[model samples]
Target: MNHRCPAVLVHGWRSHPGIWNRLAPVLSDTAVPFWRFDHTAMQGAGTETIALALRDYIRAKREETGYTGPVDIVCHSMGTCIARYLLEVLDGDAREEQVRQLVGIGPPNNGSAMAELFNDPERGPEVIRRLVGVFVPEDYDPGDDTIVQEFRPRSRTIAALRRAGTRDDIAYRILLGANLTATPAFFPVFSGKTWEFAPDGGWRTTYAGDGIVPHSDSLLPGAQVDVFPTDPANLARNPELYCHTILPKNPELVARVRDYLTLSARPAARTPPRS
Candidate 1:
């Protein structure tokens, strides 16, 4: 009998397992059983706390299934940072378990500029107001959101992640959305561009993002990165569906994720010798 590695699904902050409703079946069809990590109950918990819980959850699943091998992690947004804390910080130092691949969709790998924007003294309120009902809620306070605070560009948690760096043994794949047309329908909040903090402490917008996380925040050294809708025509068709909030259910992204998760399972093709 062949051994199939399990896939762990981690959703971002303020998100639920239902986000995986579309992607799960595709993975299931590939014979990969997915274990969804639901963090909704742990609202207001810090990333470290959630990461520890994640560790415990993975251990319990391993014990239950008696499979002690490597597992692939598929995460989105803040969940990517949480999973990184587990696999690169705690588990990386302890050398306990193994993770074959860390596939992140619209990940805030370098800490989130949106988080920083939300905490800004001058522009914070207006920013929050714009995102309300679309990305956040009415009267949402960044100060009250623990996970948001932790993912800020200057947060201690992000500093720790920078110190730990990525694990050499695990493969990292990043998928980010792009609004090539800069259409308002893509993401009405910021006029279809992602907000980013400049080196000079000023704010700027860029189309190389998913209306939430910019490409600059998602790029990690040694990680394979790909931008979605390689064809601009797709975004031109249904611009709103490619935003950061809806990436998990995006048909293009789901298919790409399925391909990444099942890559190892497929037998490698024979290489022809040079003539």
Candidate 2:
């Protein structure tokens, strides 16, 4: 019997299961089942509410499969936050659920600074305009976005995540992209740099990010982080594909995720070589 844990895939905000279309094949194996969780139906719902639904989905899957073994969770962007809330907050205290690994791609573990930027009175409008055609639609409104609000730097959801902390039993792996070329093709809005909130109450851009999530934002005390395309030439070759929105489909990133999910043990973090 194949005892390898099942893999659960979670898509980020404003994203659909299609994002995993490229990765699903690599992760597909006769022994390991790939379960994709679609949150599009709950687009306007809060993270907690969506997470509750996720809990129910997992429970139902377990009941249907009769597989009580640990499952590996692979999520992207905001979906990472939702998965963490379910694993570390809701299931943390009880320690009853079985989750072997939590792999997050371009996750906003420290809360999304972009969410904060969207609500900024001075910069919100321009930022929204820049991301309209690319990351969001022309009619996008952060105020009307409950999930976005919950992911802001100082939101209650972020606070709860901090208080709950990560579970020791689960291995955490984070994959982040670096915009080495600083090309607009990588991400036009921020020019390949990620938005970050400074301690002095100001916004700044940094290259140590995937044009959406800054390295600092995804860094957790115990989680291992790996930046993609250790060679700058690789990113220079196809800068557009390394952006936040398209990361899940990037071939190189998908391969790394495959290795992480299938490897017998957690590997050491791989940092990009300094230019």
Candidate 3:
């Protein structure tokens, strides 16, 4: 498909442009021209900082590519948070119109409890509190801070963003990671005693969710939602679907993104014949 507008790929927290390395070729395969957004220090950068950087990138892309049409956006994790701020919070009439569709991979659209888990001074361990603070900025006044404030479940920024929802002129697609059977070994280390044994009686703990953001938190209120299996083995076997970390490499995801960009859909996957 010959896209009139360029597709922009935004990487989430503590990430670089290299995150798109696996996904870019698939987009190119469909003849979709794309751009990767580069930003600094997800660990330290606030939401406003990331938003302004994205704004600059959009402006630069428009000038450099000389494309007057709307740009399609693809984002992962916290990158979607930044994109939402740009779309819902920023006041740019022309820029707003220039966004055609937004495809988010593993976004915390409704805010993540993970933030509140750490930000809760009364309950959260002191060490974890400091570490979590790096990613989530604190809310001081009624309407300030940046990344941290915006991601807390009950924060003013998140509530406002939720109320705004997606723009009428823009289309949205949200991909979710549903299974959370696997978690990093370090999660236990950081979780302290936060993880408890299941009352249902098994060798397992509670469903920790995608190892990061919970599945429920990933859904945007008004967007079309697509759920992918989050079991690592299933993801590995499918190769076409993804968990949060490898979303860009998921073949199914790449195809959907291409379809979204081209304004067309690939035929539904056919079931293989039983031997």
Candidate 4:
């Protein structure tokens, strides 16, 4: 292990490393080397598949960096699920302990009702297929399964992963958006205004959440929760603010994450990527 451990950044579903465009500079300023973990961007790849791939990536990074100790993880959206599985489910006690801190930005830790909208068997799947086209390029094949299919509230995969719960050894910070219409009316309505059946089969009260995930769902039982700032105009109508897609673009949010790493993590030597 090097004198310091590096931080790993994992992007959310249907997203690529480019999403870190804004946060990268902030992390660099902290003097801690960071790496981005990219997946196939196919939500249907399955959570276990993604978690295993992350495990492999972490192992490779460890070997290449010669840092056997735990590293920090910063994940956005569904990426939080994958990181949790890697740390709490797949990794051994010794290896899991190496994870120093985890910061989840707009993470759907519980589950998002939005997924159920498109994952519905009758008409939802088709809407999902069409929606996938809008986000990914034509060449990208999401196959039969989709991330939307997995993210539906009360999905089997999410249930399985939730069994392990968040690790107490790792420090966690969950950042959620509080507004639904901060941008413009034309923007898709992803705010927490929607509600879904809870695990107990009761209807959850609807409130403002990040455009994609409700603030309540974004929360973890033990992790610290920080609501992102809302647009100045929407403050009155929308006390809670921030959209799912814009999590990385917020300067204040990025600075907060950077500050966490700066204070919580020490600088580590750079490691070259494997050829």
lDDT of each: 0.86, 0.85, 0.64, 0.66
TM-score of 2: 0.94
| Residue 113 lDDT in candidate 4 | 66
Please give, for residues 88-127, the per-residue lDDT of candidate 1 as tens digits: 8888788787898999999999999999999899988998
After superposition, the stretches of candidate 3 with alpha carbons farther than 4 Å from their true spots are: 41-43, 92-95, 121-123, 126-146, 180-209, 230-241, 266-275
- In model 4, the runs with Cα more than 4 Å from the true position are 1-4, 41-43, 92-97, 121-143, 180-207, 230-241, 264-275
lDDT of 2 at 24: 86
Tell me how candidate 4 scores on lDDT.
Answer: 0.66
Query: How close to the true structure is residue 3 of candidate 3, measured as C-alpha lDDT?
Result: 50
The runs of at least 3 residues in candidate 1 whose Cα sits more than 4 Å from the true structure, single-residue gaps closed, are 264-275
Error at 222, model 4, angstroms: 1.1
Judged by TM-score relative to the true structure, which candidate is superior, 1 or 3?
Answer: 1
The worst-scoring run of ten residues by lDDT in candidate 1 lies at 266-275
Cα deviation of 159, candidate 2, in Å: 0.3
lDDT-best of 1 and 4:
1
Question: Which of 1 and 2 is ahead in lDDT?
Answer: 1
lDDT of 4 by residue, 73-142 (tens): 9998889988887787776355654888898998878776656654445644444554454443454433
